[model samples]
Target: MMNKGIDREIDWRLRVFESLSYPTIILLPDRTIIAVNGRYLEKMGVEEEEIIGRSCREVNLRNYPEQKFPCAEQGECPLARAVHTRSGQSVLLKYHDVYGGEGWEERVFSPILGADGEVDFIIESIRDVTRVKNLEKMYSGVRELIDQVVQTSVSGIIAADRQGRIILMNRAAEELFGYSGYDIDNVNIEDYYPPGVAREIMRKLRSEEIGEKGKLPITRVTIRRKDGAEVPAEMTAVIIYEDGREAATAGIFNDLRDKLEVERQLKEAHAQLIQSEKLASLGRLAAGVAHEINNPLTGILLYASMMREKLEKDHPLEQNLRYIIEDTQRCQEIVKNLLAYSRQSNPTRQYFQLNEALGESLRLVRDQKLFLHVKVVEDAPAAPVLVNADKNQLCQVVINLIINAVDAMDGNGTLTLRTYEDRPNRKAILEVSDTGGGIPAENMSKIFDPFFSTKEVGKGTGLGLSMAYGIMEENHGRIYVKDTSPEGTTFALELPLVPMSDVILFDSIG
Candidate 1:
């Protein structure tokens, strides 16, 4: 019964071998080919009858086994080594087909031992792994480049979809937005902007409101921070292209904080200098007038007081005496103001709230002739915009500007005062604008020259703007006309919070 079972198993194995798809070849211990499957004969382009009994040197690959191919003469061929060493061997091999096309394959060859305790035949099974290896190489190169590019970029680079889903981001972008690229993927850009800013910016871009012929596409925008604060940024975005099609937008972002801060400091310094100059000029004018006018006024007042003491209440002399005394006192007051204007008074710098200064200046001008026919508007922050400055001096600068605006309007137009901190540079700015006939182009440049005036002779000495300019310079700040249109002109007073070191030293001596 056992012998019958063994014979049955051998018959089943032969049937299984013929049904296998993989090419299998058997070689004799003398390195001769004894048999090959139908698939092997097809691969070699030969009939089984012609190849089955041929020597490896005849039917086997001619380019191998005699030093013509890799691993052949070294006795490292899996088939040869498997039989010679009586063990199993596996290797990769390249073969040239009968038609001369190259093919790469992996093969495992094993020695089949006979009952006599010696190798009987070597069986080899082969497979192809070409496509898999090529794919791995391609993917590896791509991955390495992606890592290198992300690390070396400077500007914040971001690539996202229309839905604001972040698809690609570089290190600079990660730092600028204050969010990790990994964390921002798929997040909306709206999450980083003020309520309407993002939408408005997009609308502008689509409408070509920002970029046109001869215009740059660069934009100043406000970005919303994760902490609910808004930060200013300048961004430039270009439509990416791939194979002549619009792929996505690649945006480069620059944080505006530093720029805005520098602007603020410059503006503050300008305002302070203007105030200083105005005051110094006033002081000098006062000193000159007080000595010259006070003497005459004092004589007038002395006579008037004596006349009042001697006159009866019902007498005509009393009325005239009272008139003289009152007029003399008014002259005295005018001289005092002039004195205040002419002298140099060092400013006590501190964190001053801008809104308060603007309010006070407006109130000072509200009842003036210039404001009588003009509509004045104040668009300033509600918060305390702390800036390093001398409060009194800054207030004087604002007052001067309001008065100048009112004068520019001739008491018959609209005046607007706007104040805010330009966060990018950390500087505060106050813009005073008037809706009046714009300054004559020719006169605009000279408007700040000392004693230059366009008003009626007695109405103005043309000293106000010059004084304003001097004050701004002394305080390490700048004041200039930023823009003008048919409707009116805008005067922008840009100041810095802290005076520069040079400014401090110069002011000390001045």
Candidate 2:
């Protein structure tokens, strides 16, 4: 009963198969077209009645003079081998169509076996995979091009996972970090950066605190080299993702040793120029001192003018008296300003309050109407921020910065003055910020250079800030511009704080 049921199922399968539209062709064990559906007969350009009893040679393979059917006789074909060995197999074969002479076809032959383990029939299915094959070829070519590019790049490229293990290191990376590509793969990235710097960076990365796109987090750091020397470098990192998951981070580093040396040399050159200007101004003031001596002698001339007006009625010395008075007053004013500009004049060094110094400087410029249209804001802590600096020199620095701020604003804008303590190193800081046309990029490097002024001719000698910088340096302090943008510029001065013991001694000496 089971045998009968199996036979019945097989007969039903053959009946259902003939109803399909695909070109289904069944080949007999003798390599003859024993059965075919309507689609097969249409594809092969043969009548169903004529092809059922015909051998495979009549429909095709007639050109093979050596084998009756090249597929079966050669026994090398996948379908042929499967039939001979009574094992199932699949193989791709190319053939020309008789009706469509210009087209070629790829056919898949699947061999089937009987219960006796002999070849029963073969089912062939065909498809055109030409477009898919072309796409595969294009992808392979692109991969080859990318491989060539990476091999020849000059910049070092390194990628690491969230765990800090390196996944990729190019040839340049091998030379830069002093490790071969093979040695770095799977190694921790911490071995490159200075101790603790790597951990800090990783913490920021985990917290998403790094700079956003269109910006860079340029942190100067020291990286360990293969020879054990730490190299100064500016590092930049970028995050990468794959399939919506964080995959790794890529880092690129540039050497800063040469750039730093160049900046140092420029600073030295600028310092020398300032020192020369200071000496030159001293010489000019010395010549003016000789002329100033005539001021006291001119007082005698004024008394003679009065006597002449009282006793010498015939002389009429009124015009001479007027000339003497005018020249003497001019000499006195010159002598006063000359003393102020001369650095040789010893300014009293004291623990002066920053707010007092700012008040003094503002008072000097306040009488002028230049600041009328401008808003001057002062933001400082209430605590006394005292420093050991020459009182006049400190006032001068503040005055120069304030005047420059006014000039930059070009008549109407905001100016800010602030003071605070640099607690870490025991320093007091004063900052002057202004809203105005900012300095140009090219002139920024030369802003502190003596006589390098951008102001209109006769409006500036550019010696004010240069002098300010020199005075700050002499007091064991430093001054610099923090930033400049379209909005404005900010100048900052940091001076070391004087302890209470020194302040008392200074006041006693005074």
TM-score of 2: 0.44
For 1-510, candidate 1 gives per-residue lDDT tens digits of: 999999999889877767668788878887677777777766667777777667765554542432243343554556667767888888766655658765567777889999987998888776765566567667989888976776667767777666667778788777777778668854676676788876665565455556752222778888876667778898876655578654555566788899899998898577656656655665576677778988999999998899799878899778878888898998886665454445345667655566777787777667855556788788987765555666666677778777777777777888898987777886778899988778888886567765688888877656567656655655666678888877888887777743345446656888
Residue 5, model 1: lDDT of 98
Question: Please, what are the lDDT tens digits per residue for candidate 2 over residues 17-123?
Answer: 77766677778766677778777767667677877777665655543233233355654665566677665555433333445332323555667867976668877
How many clashes in each structure? 40, 0
Q: What is the C-alpha lDDT of each candidate?
A: 0.71, 0.72
Model 1 / residue 284 / CA error / Å: 2.3
How many Å off is the CA of 238 in candidate 2? 20
User: Which 10 residues in a row give candidate 1 its minimum summed lDDT?
Assistant: 63-72
What value does the lDDT take at residue 446 in candidate 2?
72
